[model samples]
Target chain A: MEYPSRLIENAVGEISKLPGIGKKTALRLVLHLLKEPEGTTAELTEALTELRTKIKYCKDCHNISDDEVCNICASHRRDRSIICVVEDTRDVLAIENTAQYTGLYHILGGVISPIEGIGPSELNIDQLLQRIENNKNEVKEVIFALSPTMEGDTTAFYLTKKLRQFGVKISTIARGIPIGGELEYTDEITLGRSILSRTAYQQD
Target chain B: MEYPSRLIENAVGEISKLPGIGKKTALRLVLHLLKEPEGTTAELTEALTELRTKIKYCKDCHNISDDEVCNICASHRRDRSIICVVEDTRDVLAIENTAQYTGLYHILGGVISPIEGIGPSELNIDQLLQRIENNKNEVKEVIFALSPTMEGDTTAFYLTKKLRQFGVKISTIARGIPIGGELEYTDEITLGRSILSRTAYQQD
Candidate 1:
C-alpha cells in the first residue's frame, strides 16, 4: 500500500519481516508505538537491540544468558545430574513454569530437520556430548523433552544411541490424553499410547 | 515465565505490550530474532525508533507525513476541491488501495468516544474547519469516509452540523449489503437498509 510517509512504510516493512506478523499487523503495531509515549518505543528499541547484540548463550545448555553460564546451570540447588534436553529456550521456560522438574536444560537450538538444512551438527549437539563426557558420573538421567514431532523423534533416537554408551538412563515426556481430556475426543494414536503406557495405579 | 536472561525478559515484556501479543508470543518472537542474524534485529529496532521519533504529521490533513504537508495534499494532480475525511492514516491507505479516489484527504486522528473521554477537541476538527474556510471557493465537496461504528456516526452527526453553514456539498459512503455479500448470511439491519435504499434496476 502507498503510505503517506516513507518512515511509516519502512517501519511497517521492517516489523512485518518477523514471524507471524503481516503488513497490516505491522502497520497497526507501528501506529500503536507512534501513539504511545516516546519513552515506550525507545525502551522497546533499546531492549531488542541489546538482546540481539549483547546477549550470550549459556556455556552448558546454550540457553540465553547475560553471562557465560546460565543461572539454572550455575545454581547449585538445581539437579545438574538430570539434564532435560529440548529444542530451544522457550521449552526451557515452559518446563520451568510447570514446577515439576528441578533439573538443568540442554537447548538443542533446533530439531533435526533435513528439509531446513538443520541437522545434529547444526545445533549444540557437540557441546551437549562434551558436557555429558565431562560430568559422566554426576549426570544420571537425561529426559528428551522435545516436541512430539517427527524431527523431535529422530533427534531423540540419535541422542539415545549416543547417551546409552555413557550408561545414563534416558526417558521421554509422556504424550497421551491430557489430565482433563475426554476419552471420546482423544485422538486414536494418543489414546492407544495412553492405554499401552498405563502404570499400576497406587491409591494415595 | 522466568527467562534465562534479563535482556530477553525485558525485550519480551516490551514486545508483549503491543496489541494481540502475549508473553508466549513475545518470547517466541524474541527467540526467532535471537536465532536470526544480528543485522535483522538491529534494522527493525532502527526503523521503528526512527519512525516513532522523526515522523511528522501533515500540516494540511493531520495525517502521518515526512514533511509539513503530506504527499496527497501537496500533489498537483489530486483533486483539491474534494476531501475524504477518515479517522487515521490506515483509512487513507485502504482507500488509496482501491485505486478509485483522486481527491485529497483529512485525517481526524480519532473518533468521538465518550467512554474513552475523546471528543471533537481531541481530533483535528478545528483544522478541518479552518481549511474549509480558507479554501471556501475552491473546495466543493467533503466525503465522510469514516468507518461504520457508533463513534463514527456520532462524529459524522457532529461534522454535518458544523459543515452545514459552509454551503459545501457533504456526503457519506454508501451503507448496505456488501458487493459480494450473501443475502442469507447478511445481518438484519444491513439487509433492511439495502432493501430500503434499493435503486430502480435499468437494463444496460
Candidate 2:
C-alpha cells in the first residue's frame, strides 16, 4: 500500500518487524502514537532502548536481570537446593505467577532444536552443570520444567545424561490434562497420561 | 506479573500502553527485541521518534504528509472537480487501495462524537468549508465516505446543512450487505437498507 508520508511508512515497516504484528496493526499502533502526546513516543522509545542496551542476564540462572544475579537467585527465602529449568524468561514469569514453586530457576535461553541449529552448547547447560558441581551438597534436586515438545524432551534427555554423574536427583514436571479441562475434550495423549499418573484421592 | 528487571518492567509498561497490546504481549515483544541485534531496537526507536517529531499534515486535505501538500493533492491525474470527505488518513488509504476513486480527499480528522466531547469545531470542518468555497467553480461534487455509525451520520447531517448553500452536488457511498456476505447472517439494519435501496439487477 502507498503511504502518504515516508516517515509513516518507515515507522510502520520497523514496527511490523515484530512477530504477530502486520502492516495494518503496525499502522494502527503508529497512528495511535501520533494521536497521543509526544511524550508517549519518547517514553516508549527510551524504555525500549534502555531495555535492549542495559538489560542483563542473571549470572547464575541466565534469566533477564538488571544486575549480575537475579532476584530469585539472590533471595534468601528461595530454595537453593532445588532448581526448575525452563526455556526462556517468559516461562520463568509464567511459573512465578503460579506461586507454587519457591525454588530457583535455570533459564536455558532456548531448547536444543536441531532444525533451528540450537544445540546444548547454545543454551546455558554448561553453567547449570557447573552450578550443580560447585554446590553439589547444597543443590539436591533439578526439575525439568520445559515444554512437552520434541526439543524440550531432547534437551532434558541430554541434560539428564550429562548430569547423571553429578548424583543430583533429576525429575520433570508432570504431564496431564489441565486443572479445569474436561476429560472428554482433552487430547488422547494428555487424557491417557492423566489416567496413568492418577494420584490417590485425598479428603479436604 | 513480577518482572525480574525494572528496565524490562518499564519497557513492557510503555509498550502495553498502546491499544490492543497487553502486559504479556508487550513483554513478549520486549523480549524479542532483546534477543535481536541491538541495532534492531535502535532502528525501531529512531523510526518512531522521527515519525512523531517530523510528520506533517497536508495543507489541502489534512492527511498525514511529509510536505505542505500531499501527493494526492499534487497529482494532476486526480479529478479536482470531486472531493471525498473521510474521518482520517486511514480511510483515504482504504479508498485508494480499491483503485476505483480518482477524486481528491478532505480528511475531517475525526467525526462528531458528543459523548467523547468531540464537536464540529474540534474537527477540520472550517477548513473543509473554506476549501470548497475557494474552489466553488472547479469542485462539482462532495462525497461522504465516513463509516456508517451514529457519529458518522450526525457529522454528515451537520455538514449537509452547512454545505447546502454551496450549490454543489452531495453524495454518500453505498451501504448494503458486503460482497460474499450471506443474507441470513446479515445484520437487520443493513438488510433493511439494502432492500429499501434495491436497484435493477445488472449483468456482468
Candidate 3:
C-alpha cells in the first residue's frame, strides 16, 4: 500500500529491515517514534550509527567488542586454558547470564550447514586449530558448547576427530527434555537425551 | 551480567526503546545489522537522522509534511471543505491506503486520555476550530475517523459539543465487530454499532 508521506514510508522501510520486524510492525514502530521528542529518535539513530562504527570482531575470541579484545577474553580471572566453543554470540551471553561459567570463549561465528552453503572453509576453524596447536601443552579442556542441532553435532564430531591428535579433553552440555516444556516442543535437549539414554546410536 | 562487549550492549539498549522490542529481540536485530555491510547500516542511520531534520507538520491541517503544507492539504483534487480528524499520521496512512477518501486531514497528534495526562489543550483542536472559522462557509463536513476506544469516544463527544456552536455537519465511521475477528476477542463493537445506529442523532 502507498504511504501518505515519504518520511513515514522511509521510517517504516528502515524499521522493517530489522530482524523479525514485518511491515505492519515497522509502521507501528515508526508511528510510535514519531510521537516521542525529536531528540529521542535522534538518540536511537545516533546509537545505531555509532554501534556499527565503534564495534568490531575481537581478535582473541571473535566475539563482538569495542576494543581489540572482548571483555570475556580480556578478563584475567577467567580460565584462559579452557575455552568454551559456541556457535554465536547469543549463546555466549546466554551462558554468561547464568553466571555458571568463568572460562574463555571461542565464537565459531556460525555452525557448519551444507544446506546454507556454509562449509568448513567459510568458518574460522583454521584459526581455532592454530590456537589449539599453540596451547596444546597448556590447555586442559576444549568444551564443545555449541547447540545440539545436527549441524552442531557435525561440527562437534569434526572438531573432536581433528583435535584428538592434540590430546585435549572435550565435553558437551548434558541434554534432556526441558522443564515446563511440552513433549512436542522439546528441542535438541529431549532428542539428544533420548539418543544418549539409549545403548548407542542405532537403527530406528 | 556483563555483556560480552559494550557495542552489543549499546545497540541492544537503543533497540529496546522501540515499541514491543525487548532486550532479547534487540540483540537479534543488532546481530542481523552486524551481518550487513557498512553502506546498508549507514543508509538507515542517515535516513533516520534526516527524518527529524526534514519532516514538519502542515500549518493548515497539522499532518506531517516535508513542506510548508502537506500534499493532501495542498492538492487541488481533494475536497478542502471536508476534513477528516485522526489520532496520528498512522491513521492517515491507513485511510490513504484504502484510497477511498479524498478530503483533507487534521492530525490531533493524540487523543484525550486523562490517565495519560493528555487533554484538548495538548491537541491541535483549537487550530481545527480556527481553520473552520477562518474558512467559514467553505468548510462542510468534519468526519471523526478516530479509533473506536473510550478515549476516542470522549474526544469525539467533546469535539461535537464544541463544534455545535459553529453550525457544521459532523459524522463518524460506521461501527461493527471487524471482519474475520473471533467473537471471544470482540470488544464493545456491537454496543458501539447500536449507539451509532440510533435515530436521534440523525438530522432528518
Candidate 4:
C-alpha cells in the first residue's frame, strides 16, 4: 500500500476533490496515470487548467460559450421572437438536442426557492422583463419551461403575473403523465394535467 | 438538454477531466455543486487552486508532506533501517493504513516498462542506491513491495541484481493461487502461485 512518493500523493489529493471521487478511487486513478506515458498527466492537467480559463457564459442566453455570445444566441437561424425560459443552461442544451425547438432561450439561472432565501430580486427576472419590453415589436410568445417542482411553479406564477403587464402571450409547458407511462405508476404529472385541462380553467 | 448557463457547462467540463468521470457523471456532480450554497463552488475552486500549492513531496522518502519532510520519514518511532520500496505515494498510504509495518519507505516513482520507453534510468533507483550508500552503517532490509505484474516482476528482478552488489536482502511479495478454490475460475494470483510453488523446472 505504500506509494512510490509525494508526487503521487499530491496528484491523488487533487483528484479526490473531484465529484464522486473518493480516496480509493483517487488512488486508482493516480496509479493508472502513473502507468501511462510520461505526458498523460500533463495533458489532463492542461485540459483542467484551460477548462476554467477559456470557457465563459454567453452574455445573452447564458449558455456555455468560448466567445462572448453562445452559438444558440448568435445563430440567426433560430427564432428571435420566441424565447424559451428555462431553469438552467443544461435545460437549454437538452431542448436544443431535440432539434425541435428553434427559438432563442433565456436562462433564469435558477428557480425561486423561499427556503433558500432566493427571491425574485436575486434572479434574472428584471432582465427578462426588460427583454420583453424592448422586443415588443418583434416578440410574440414566451414559454415557461422550468421544472415541475414547487420552486418552478412559484417562479412560473411570478413570471406570469409580471409578464402579463408586458402584453405578451405566456404559456407553461404542459404538466401531465409522461408518454409511455402506466396509469398505476402515473406521477403527479397526470394529476396536474387533469387540473390544468379542467373546463373551468379554459378561457370562455 | 439546455444548461441554465455557461457556468454549468464550464463546471461540468472541469469535473469530467478527473479520472473515471464521464459526461453524465460530470453533469450529476455539477448539479450537486449547483444545489449547494453559493459558497460551494468557491470552496471547490479554492481546493483545486491550492491542491498543488500546499502539498509538497517528502525530501527523504518522497511521500507527500506539508513541511520539509513527511511524518513517517521524520518520526523517531519508525524503523529507519528497514526501507520498503514501493511504486508511488498511494502505496505508502495503503501500507500505512494496514499499520503492520513501521519502517521507512523509498518511492520508485514507477516500475520499469520497456514497452513504454521507461527504463531504470527514469526511476529513482539512483536515489535509493545513494541512500543505501550514504547510510551504510544504519541500513539493513530493503523490501521490494511491487505489484504482481510483468513490469513489476521485471523491475523487481532488475533491482535485485543492482542491489546485490550492495549486499542488501531483496524479496518480492508472495504470489500464488488465492484463498478461494475454483480451479476453473482461478485468477492470475492463484495461477502464479501454483507455478512459483512448483517443485522445480523438470527436464523435458
Q: List DockQ, one per candidate, in order.
A: 0.88, 0.92, 0.64, 0.16
Off by over 4 Å in 1: A202-204, B200-204
Candidate 2 residue lDDT tens string, A1-204: 999999999999999999999999999999999999999999999999999889999999999998999999999999999989999999998999999999999999999999999988899999999999888899999999999989899999999999999898999999998888888999998889889998899989
Candidate number with the higher lDDT (1 or 3): 1
Better of 1 and 3 by DockQ: 1
Worst 10 residues of 2 chain B by lDDT: B195-204
Name the DockQ score for candidate 4: 0.16
lDDT of 1 at A16: 92
Candidate with the larger TM-score of 2 and 4: 2
Question: What TM-score, computed on C-alpha atoms, does each candidate reach?
Answer: 0.96, 0.96, 0.90, 0.69
* A1-204: candidate 1 lDDT, tens digit per residue: 788888988998999999999999999999999888999999999999889999998888888899999899889899878999999887888888899999889999999999999988998888989999999889999999998889999999999988878999899999889999999999998999989998788999
Q: What is the C-alpha lDDT of each candidate?
A: 0.92, 0.95, 0.84, 0.74
Error of 3 at B85 (Å): 1.0
What is the lDDT for B85 in model 2?
A: 97
For model 2, what is the error of residue A90's alpha carbon versus the real structure, in angstroms, after optimal superposition? 1.4
Question: Tens digits of per-residue lDDT for model 4 on A90-168?
Answer: 6876887888899888988889999989999888889888888888887899999999888999999999999988777
Candidate 4, residue A37: Cα displacement in angstroms equals: 12
lDDT of 1 by residue, B159-187 (tens): 99999989999998888888888999999
lDDT of candidate 3?
0.84
State what share of the real interface contacts each candidate retains. 0.99, 0.99, 0.67, 0.17
Clashes per model (N, Cα, C within 3 A):
0, 0, 0, 37
The worst-scoring run of ten residues by lDDT in candidate 2 chain A lies at A175-184
